[model samples]
Target chain A: MNKKTPKSYENMLEVKNLKTYFLTDAGIVKAVDGISFSLRQGETLGIVGESGCGKSVTNLSIMRLIPSPPGKIVDGQIIFEGTDILALPENELRNIRGNKISMVFQDPMTSLNPFLRISTQMIETIRIHQDISKKEALAKSIEMLKLVGIPAAEERIFNYPHQFSGGMRQRVMIAMALSCEAKILIADEPTTALDVTIQAQILELIQKLSKKLNTSVILITHDLGVVAGMCENVCVMYAGKIVEKAKTDDLYKQPAHPYTFGLIQSVPRLDKAKDGKLFSIEGQPPNVIDLPPCCPFHPRCHKVMDICRNQYPPTVDLGNSHEVSCWLYAEHKELADA
Target chain B: MTKYIIRRLLGIIPTLLIIITLSFFIVRVAPGGPFDTEKKLPEVVMRNIEAKYHLDEPLVVQYGRYMFDVLRGDLGPSFRYKDHDVNFYIFQSLPNSMILGVIAISISIIFGISSGMLAAVKQNTWVDYLSMALAVVGISVPLFVIAPVLQYVFAMQLGWLPTSGWFTNGDGWQTILLPAVTLAFADFATIARLTRSSMLDTLRSDYIRTAKAKGMRSSSIIFKHAMKGSMLPIVSYLGPAFAGIITGSVVVEQVFRIPGLGKFFVQSSFNRDYTLIVGVVIVYSVILVIMNFIVDVVYSLLDPRITYK
Candidate 1:
């Protein structure tokens, strides 16, 4: 922000009131309602949410990769490295994508071009950003592939995507994303399509490589355990808004929003022996189409108050930068005034 | 790939045999022989004529004899055309038909791919609507109607071309222009519609999104990533289409007054010239089979996932 002169330079990314809407025959679906967050260098920020909660949409908005026609970013300003990405021209914006910032998608099977060799896909990504020869670009691609734990990466790079296993394809995806030493990496459920063991390996590879490259990461996933292990800070999104934000440890110790509380509770606790039944949050996520100006998680909140139904809750700051948008978190005097 | 082609070429023998046998019998099933005439010849003269052409022999023996001749690459004598064999007529017209067909297909590919890609990339816009509307007209109107209409406009009304003829002057290729364009019109429409839809589907694919996400130049994304996938349908179609066009369209040839294999195909049937009819069929079948083989090879090249084995 113009007001925070010095701190803005320190932050890697700043998303201000980002809202992405999809215009359909039924209505305007606010896939990502007004939400704000920031990421800093070498810090992994996890976006945790159930399906359709705008975790992926928010990142896609950052990348400016939302498919047009039906999809549009209604209101948003994504500031990266002191420049407004939303206002930048196409030529300028392209330099930011896959160079300054890159993303890994959810499904590895469909994410890659099947007809092309891994070398072609990787070299294309690398050569677009840097003015390198094809041979050099291919060499860099093989290096990145090897770094991501692919065996015989030099030979394998020439093979088509279909020839690779699911886990190997995801590894290639990561290698392509990190090939250029991008400042920020966005991984949208990168491990979702893989089995449990492969998922851990990919997550670990991402963590290890990004750390070595000193790349800040915005990791979007539904797995709280992944967040607990991998993220320094975490955001809990419900419907299209971030319901809570805090340091991972502190949030685990004390979840401020009922939705966050429900998410943490729902996870099977390894510390406890044979629980009778797993805890689950009641009610489905609100339909985002023409959604009301109120708390989206209100229906499922245990402490749902009258104020939550008609009015959106303001973000309440608990000490040490922990924040929650909940009527329950409001001070009695503030509640009375409203 | 070399081995596959060799095996495929060898495999054509049995297929050609079946086609030759079927045509040899089916032509006989029709009424009247090649020698039939309204005025009955004297019995002695007719028997002498029948014996000369082996028509007096049993049908099986004649078929065996014809098969023996065909094995040595001879198509036997033409019954109607004096002092000619089936091979001579076929080989003579083939180059003329091929020249016309090649020109037609070249026009179709160039116009079809560019217009179709434009329609797809600029979908729902005026460019899309205009090109698609033209394609619809092309597909709906048949060659017989289209050729004359084209001739009417370019030749009669505009006086830009000859009315109907091949090589108006000994070296005049201007005659080929009208007919080739007419021949290409329908196929252009087919290719355009196919390319438009296939490109649309491929453009929406996850890989295309990844290409965009990688910040690829729009031209590269389209040509490198989207083009090959969209071309699959068109490549598969090109085989049979080439076979049909190379032999030429009967209506296309007739309306334009051009000599092509299709003319022979129509006349040989009417004349009940059994050997000539079978020879034409053999040419069309060989071209069709060979074209399909080329398509499969191209498929493997375009999509690494495909393998002949």
Candidate 2:
């Protein structure tokens, strides 16, 4: 990347050869295979994929947020701001979390404590990594709520989670996540559980906050439209690997990988010809617990080669910050070989 | 909430009536009368004794009379405790029992909840092991055993506290410590175990994870998020447990030589003191009812999901 890159950008996060596996009772499940990516400062790197495609797991690995016993990062280098966070001590990792980085989860209803008023939850979080008094914490919380575009912030702070709608609860979650002014915000499908209008509002809030704070974001979602609308850089994940990465416009214009093309085509496009059929990717994603020996997506790739069935394709550069892992481009054979 | 509470209040009628009727019959059928003794007395004297107490009457008539007396705020005289009315004996002993119960419940709840939470947060550590070990001991060792052992260790061997009685005199609270601790020992154990398990469950909730994700401190997550959520189960256990504590273990009272209600209860039971035994049973039943009612109310308060009805 350094050899070919223009020198105007600095990466906020760089994850290399990250493998997060779950030591389940049945077998070892490689939730995140050997995946590598870099997010530049203030960039919205959208990780778009189906459920079980390891997008969420990748974000969790970056945050060191995986619940252990079953889930473990067996091998990885999650370098945030020149520090390998995976190797950091527990105490230091905690400081990095919610200080340098914060995460917003899905299901706002279950995510927020129903018994507690929003003020109590938000203020306590402010006080955790800050030495502020209760009054200061409270003020900061209200400020955050206002920043998230919550109306009547002062009155809403005292309301319980049940009193708020799903959209409002999610806004509150986003507010709490942003309260620490984290450098990298990992929002795992933050709006998936809300209505479409609310989803738009939450995405807009996230986009506005990212710009305002200059926070690099890893937006993990399965919706291609979400990635298209909000993210500048998109990582198309399939079965625990990033199969394609590029500038969103370039990828949408000319998808290099067969899987990426299939994903984009599968969605109902308004620009499609009248009576044009919606494309569908055939077959379910390969089961992680007992996956095949070759490329996990080979069975469903439209441009599957003989080699694709037996050997995994190394990522190939399509030039100008675009990369695709596929055997379709023969001229890039040397890149795959390397 | 008012409707729910009113419905629960209405439930108490059948509960009390059943307890009264059961106590009446069970006390009567327990193989001995209050007048039973080894020495024989003159026939006329025995008849007079039986007639005065209405002991010679039919069982149904006796039950009716007992219910009437209870309704009229009279529990009758203690046939065994020569000089005292049953109410007098109960009133004399109730305060000491309540004190023991309150102290025991308070200590148990505070220590148990705090320790359980610590154990959950710092799970698999020494603190967790220590708290769990205490729970195991509390559950396995009966109060009868714990009371005597505590008395011997704290009173006789250590000499740090008094050995027996509710008070040094009739009013001063100087000598009640040993007995209170003895009576409370098992209650503490039960509460600790319940609190620990409930806290463990609460700590595992998704909301707790969410709180942590929000950058909430471990202390706040445990106290505000987990502890409050765990209260419903602990509250449910509290009612029955509180009644158990207030009733005072008869064996513990005897071991500590405390002239509490538990001591009176044992004496009455042994001598087949019909009116006294019946009176004690009725009093215990009422305590159980009131405690359960309180538990229901507390349950509704702690969990909005629960309704008293």
Candidate 3:
């Protein structure tokens, strides 16, 4: 299925109808089933989803870093800088990995090599994508570390990862991710593992660094608060598909899809009365390995209609760059057109 | 680090003392005496031999005498090999055994690590299967069986290399080859299996994925990132494995007829040569203690988080 989107120079990265599937012993797992989105230059796009909704898979696909044998991008176009990254050779993709597009992972404790010192990891990452001397790379590494608010970075650089605390390790990861001056940074749940206070600090650091470097970012997370605070645009995903996409403010103000609406309402609000019963989305996420032919969310959707069970909903643009994929919107669109 | 090494060295003294005390008593308690041969010597001749070595004295006196000689850096005379002292036999034969042990261990580590890495990197493929299959064979079959089979194939049938006997001169490696291979075969398999499993675990670690995300080459990731962590298990194993291999050489020595400490050890045990038995045991204990100490030091080096305190 060719679902290619027209190339746009204004956008730094456009993932057009990407499908990353895992051929496991049980069955085929549609981890990222035909999701599409674009990031404009210097913009932060948040992909908010529950566990196993394929948010992380989408980012891995963009980097072509998915482990094979069990996983493969069955079809897609990852257009970056007007070139389809999916079609590029392995060697060419390697150059883009940390050079033009870098990533920060969730668990900072395991992300940095334990045997290597902080300086070694950061300097090596810098030298991989740039032609620079070891001394120059070391200087740049320490500079990046200091920029991330790390104290005593010059001395700390010589210490192994185990010497760093959880917050400090995340800072180092960020420094390494940004050391190459990448154009787009993909952070997969970067703050999920930190404390609430540290989470806010890490988010602020990422935001400040991205703005300073003028680098686009794809921040994958399940916390709406993080998205609302740091991201300019947000994509709400469910069962490996984008169910809602809008400006962060618009998404918080008016969630179109039932899933997105349920997610927002589930969050404990301070303004609400002190009630024991919190709003929760009923039913579990559908098994991606054996997903239904129709809309995967129909089983759990509160406002499910007749067509929702028999057919997949088409994505409908609701003007002002807001989009929703739900039968309710589809029906509304039909009535409006008629 | 130097303090740690010194502390570990000092600890070996009491350890060695305890080992020596136990082995001394245990050997004395066993049924046979040093002069109890099938062809008995005259009673007067036997008495003279026992008296010369202070064996006729009371057990407590004999123990004190032995300890005194040991403190004076003397292992006493061998009862079996007359006119030769215990130290003479040990010093004469230890170098050959050390050469064999070193060669065997080196071969085992090099082959084991490489094969294990290949198996892990190509998991579930033919290379992995073949290497694991060979490793299973190596581990299951006894070294005695391997020794004869190798000698039969390479020496008797093929006639490519000498069957036994070590030579110190140039190109003596040919004579050392079969015995060393036989001695190392099982350990090689053990290390290979250990490395493969450890490497598989290391390869799956999040840091390896992080390395890949950094655009580091696969070779660099495997060698620099995965290797150091994976080596922890192998290093721990090598300490005891080194001592085991040295003692295990007794069987290989018999099969190959190579003159080494293993040959002396077996002969001394059978002949009830008290001084010789204790001397060899002490030497083996020293090697073992030092090796384990070295392994601990290497462990800290591989993983910097480990400190001596």
Candidate 4:
């Protein structure tokens, strides 16, 4: 067990060797398999993956929000501010959930209770963690609405969720998430359900607010473009495992893992030739329930080798905090040893 | 909102008029007359009886006369009772039936809601299975069977309560209990099933997940968040269920020997008391319409997304 924190020692949250699985009647589905990452205070980490690649599951496990019976955190350690959140009692965990660590979900249309007024929802959230009267909490809610650039915040606060548009509802969601001055916020594809124009506005709001509040953020999305624009560091996930991780600029400059390279190439770029066709990775992501014995991506890897079919590749550091799991890296390791 | 309520109220007038017209003709069209008896009277005596009540008038004229009298707050003479008019008999018997109905509905709501919520919260478990199984029994068995079974158990065998009759003094509650419980069981089953299914759906809603993510206590999430959303179906069910209970109380009233409107309604129908039957039908229809109107109002209250407009 590596119990040591990195020497920099300013991490706000650390997820260590987290393994979340679902016990379906068919079989066990390994949704999150031994993923680890550290978030420095005020840092933004983007987890980029295709759909069903465990990006959302990882974030849910961090918040301990996975539904049981089918979904369970098989093993994990979520250390938030040096406390093991999984080990905390439910009552104590409640304090950390929406207070220290808040979350914004994918669909703003369904996230807010349609029966309740926006002001009531916001004020209740405020009062849940803070010792404040309804009037004070209401004032705070209006202030949050104003902060999120909702026009006529005072009047709009009295309106229900159905009355708000998609972008405006998302703004309300963000306002609620930030109302408690949380130290960390997990946004699970927060702008996926909105228009392209509104997506930019929401992304800007999240980035600007995180910077202002100095709140660490874990932004999970499938869009690499979103990661490129917003994240400082990015982790590329495939088949419930992190295959490549690097500083965003370095990742864009020279992706080491085959999967990461394929992802980068797949994006249609303005700099590329107008007549050239866009690149796409062939083959589907591996089945999580019955993954191949060796490297999970070997079946789809363009750079596959005999070793990739025989055994799982170990994660190798490629210097400058960039790491990748691939037999190509293992060949480098063997050469270095020789 | 006021306009909506006014519109709903106005809609009931035509509805009641239709109900009154239909019931009036149907009762008259039936073969027996209110004056008929086992021992046949002389033809002249029968003619005088028919003329006294204006029964000899044409059907349309009779209906028009009845409507006019009703507009003046007159539910005409009860042939079976002879001394009291239909209005006097109904008003006298209504309070007992109302008390019984209110008690039965209250019992159903309290127990039904709790059991339903429990079943939903403990879904696919013994609690859910048992409550649903009980609900199936309640629905499958008729209230007539339930009334007798309850009478036998609580009244005959246990001897804890009186077997039949309404005591107007202090012990009136005891007399109503067996009948009320009998009436409540079927509605309880209906309400429980409706609530369980609706609550299960509400609990699974994304907003419930949001509530959980907000770190709300489980009780608050269930009651404050899920309960209100779940109530829309139950509220809608209550309007019809209330009317069903009142009309369906006939057998229970007979079984318990309670002098409620249901008993009088049954006797009037048997004795061919035209005015009394018509009077009861009109009252029941009005109650049904008003109950449904109230349900719509409550529906809007529970769900801010719903507007009458």
Candidate 5:
């Protein structure tokens, strides 16, 4: 724990004021408003929010994976290892996507090609970004399957996606993602579609593998518990903005923003004995197209003020690497007393 | 799997019976007899001809006798052509139509699928628009219209090749080219349009996005991922289309002066060659049935989730 501080930070990725918008027939949707963050080597960052909060959109913008016409990363600078990835040619970006930065999608069943065998899909992925003989590719693929904890890798490799259960398909997706030993992994709700037990096993596998490889991870999810368990740094998003960010322990202990506070309170804690009462955030998220002029959450925010109704709050720092955007924390010293 | 197949096979029985029964009665009901054009043959000769085909008796008896002949694979002799058995004439002309149909359909499938894939991969680009536009033009303009236009431009004006015939002295491809091109035009358009639309739908699938996320080359994604996934719809359209081509279209044969099955079918109908017409209908029906079976098998192979059983 002490080794984490003052660690010589070799910056792996720096994203500055990224903005991705979708120009739909209804109107322009600011899916990801201006947001900035940086990740150093061997770090795990958890991004948590409700759906439509831009957690997934942020990662998609980084990868330049958004479909155009309907989607576009309008303004952003994604400086990955000194090069602006947003400006790179598509071919170069293709090489970096699987080799340097890999992503595992939400639904494992549909993510895999139904027509192809597990071995075929895995081996083809390995060969695409690397030059290796068929025999070597096959061997590496089997090793990867085993690496993800599938027993009898050789025999199972030939089986189709349907032959495997849902949990196993997620394992297959993870295996494909890790085949290249990628430096950065982007897992978007990786375990959301799996059963609770399988989700835990998958989470554990990811944590162990990341530690072993010293790889960085961007865990995108709505499950606060998973984020609290796995991520070191946490970012809370609301209506496309990073409303709060802090060290995991600090964020849990001192949730600065109302949304974050609400999220932590909403999780069912056995220790609380709160009975059948589940804390529900009142109202729904704001419409992206015609959002209010001030804070998007003002209508639902319990701490709404005259200023909060007309003005968006700037981020206020709360030391120990914690920051949040909410009018309640506007007074720097007064906030400390509370 | 076997149960499903047996069900599909049994399903065809009722379909074929209806087609044969309806066509036999319908042809008989039409305005003329096979000997209508001749000088009203002597009563005895006419009665003998009708008796030979069981047409001298009641409609039910004639229908029963015709069905029996069909079961025996005996199409009977032609009324107008005289002594030329309907089955033999059909077999002789069928190969010609089959060759034309095969060549045309092959070109359509290859070009249609390839171009459709390209359009899907490069969506909203000029390639997508151009290919779609070409398909639209292909569909709107009938083959008869395109055939003469193409013939005029390439053959009459360009003089790059011979105009028509299954062959000059029945040698090789020199003669079959024009007729085949004419017959294939509409099918090529339909295939291209179907392939393009189906591929576009496939490209939007979650697996395709996963493939792209897997860091695959765009070409591999288009061919291996998109093309293979969208093939079921294309395959479904193929069975009937192929049968249509093989059975032949009369307009194309007339325009190109190729004496294929289409020409025979039309001539038999015109002359009220009842035995020959009946034979042609039966042959066409069999082709349709067989093609449909092959299509079902191909569909099952492409998507394991499909089960006829």
Candidate 6:
């Protein structure tokens, strides 16, 4: 679909101040509160955060898959291929979904329809976007199954999802998502449910496929190790907001936001076995509903400042595309707790 | 699936035997005998009547003789019906009941599933409330009340349909409509309620969300992806309900004055017509067994996870 645009299109996708909220009987939950990020044409972006930090909601908002009544995208612009998808009509949005952008969910055990054969699911996904014959769709489905390294793609394609193992099912999902050659693939914790060994293989397969197809990937996971290995750009989110953003190497080498530093410190390394006790960030993440207008991490940060309690710190640019949000990086703030 | 069906068929023999044996003994245990009347007959004449039918013999001998006759497809003669045998009467009325039941079930299924699905899809809307409200009314009102109200409205007031009886007047299907609808209304309500909850559960499943994420049309998602999963409960219900309807509805047949199995069933029990009572029970048992067998086959078809050995 980007064929209509110039070949030199820089950013494939851009999200600006996306605020997704869930209005419950208790209160309005700011699941994703005013966050922005962008993905380059072929670059993989990582969104790493604790559970309930709106990592999934941010991507779901892009797809407009969040259940309404409870969930509403209060404000946002999800610009894909120079057009804002959030503002597009449903028919236009449908043309973008699975045609230009595809999504892979977390669990494979329950994601695929148990009654439908792998062939049926795969063929439908292929045929929906492309005006292809059923025979061509079947052949393309077989090709995709083979491409995903599924053994005996010819025979296994006709079998039901229950006949396949969990890892194999996830592979089938990836194959179906990419069958239409979607430009962007949003994988939300795709390997979180797999075994440790299988996770590496799945991630490797994703990396290899994206490189081959030139598909920009937005990987959402809580694992820093996964981001370090696959993503060129990483955004660390905390309490529904991006606390820091930078090149993967720069963020790891020179962590700026206190929350980001605390997350890095929390990762247990096998190479560093001389630790007395593993580092852990004290205190739970703040409740997102009716959250205060200040840094959410202030209660847990060791370098807590008096100003951090009153006003939210502005994002500070630290060169080479590194950005952080913390009172420690603010130049105008007085030394309230020197 | 064929193997499973064959096994289920074989399993029906012992079940039918039990039903036949129980009904045979139960009818004899009732208060009056087939020949009993308000006016007493001469002792010699009573003895001759009993002797002719083998009732003068021991109860075990009569049971053995009855079983033997049943094996040869002879249900014996009805005492109260005079010349007609139990088999003859059943053959005559069963078709009428079957025709009424088939029409009723079809109508129930079409309306029930559609209304139920609509309610689930448009939950919290007026469409949901209205359909469910009608379903509740259908269930809460007994068949006797519902049957009469329909007869009065469609037959009496509207003058568009007949009030009762079948094949007596010049009218054909118009006579069958009132009773068929009466039978269907109650069953329709049950099916609708069951389907709504089932569809709601299916809609919330992960696969449904996956279908939506795939950018499937709403119709395709509901019909193609969600339909079969929700049908499990409804299929199981239709089994027994099918057998009951086909066997006959006592109230429906009586109210409409149609000649059906249920009418004979009620009459035979009242007059101590042992042979007729046992015959009707046998038909119900066989149909129930077959219907359950059908349910199992459909379950395997709808759900791939269920397999036949």
Best candidate, TM-score: 1
* Candidate with maximal lDDT: 1
Which residue pairs in candidate 3 collide? none
| B1-309: candidate 2 lDDT, tens digit per residue | 688767767887788778778877887788867777888778999999989888889988988988899888898877777797989988888776777678777777777777776777777889889988887787788777887787789878998877766663553474666666655556666666677778877776767777666555577667778877777777888888888778766776677666667776778878887777777777787888888878877766665445444
Alpha-carbon RMSD, candidate 4? 3.1
Give every collision pair in model 2. none
Q: Which model, 2 or 4, shows the larger TM-score?
A: 4
lDDT of each: 0.91, 0.81, 0.90, 0.89, 0.84, 0.90
Instruction: Evaluate residue A65 in candidate 5 and report its C-alpha lDDT on the 0 to 100 scale.
Output: 81
Off by over 4 Å in 6: A1-8, A272-277, A333-338, B26-59, B168-170
Residues B158-264, candidate 6, lDDT per residue (tens digit)? 99998987974445768888999999998899999999999999998988877877778888999989998999999999999999998889899889988888888
The TM-score between candidate 6 and the true structure equals: 0.93
lDDT (tens digit, per residue) of candidate 1 on A127-188: 99999999999999999999999999889999999999999999999999999899999999
- Write the residue-wise lDDT of candidate 4 on A223-329 in tens digits: 99999999999999998999999999999999999999999999888889587888889998888996666888898899998888877788899999999988798
- Candidate 1: fraction of native contacts reproduced: 0.71
lDDT of 3 by residue, B1-309 (tens): 889899999999999889988889999988999899789899999999888888889988988888888878898888889877999988887887888888898999999999999999999999999999989999999988898899999999999988887786444669899989988889899999999999999998889988888888888889989999999999999998898666547888788776678877778889898889998998899889999999999999999989896
Q: Per-residue lDDT of B40-146 in model 4, one digit per residue for the tens?
A: 99999999988998888887888899999988989898877878799998888778788888889889989899999999999999999999998998889998888
lDDT per residue, candidate 6, A34-100, as tens digits?
A: 9999999889999999999999999989999998878999987878888888888887887778878
Task: Give the candidate number with the greatest DockQ.
Answer: 1
- Per-prediction TM-score, chain B alone: 0.95, 0.91, 0.93, 0.93, 0.91, 0.96
Query: What iRMS does model 5 reach?
Result: 1.3
Per-prediction DockQ, in order?
0.72, 0.42, 0.70, 0.64, 0.65, 0.66
CA shift of B85, model 5, Å: 1.8
TM-score for chain A, prediction 6: 0.95
TM-score of each: 0.94, 0.85, 0.93, 0.91, 0.92, 0.93
Candidate 5 docking: what grade? medium
In order, what fnat does every candidate score? 0.71, 0.50, 0.66, 0.62, 0.60, 0.59
| Sort by DockQ, top down from the best | 1, 3, 6, 5, 4, 2
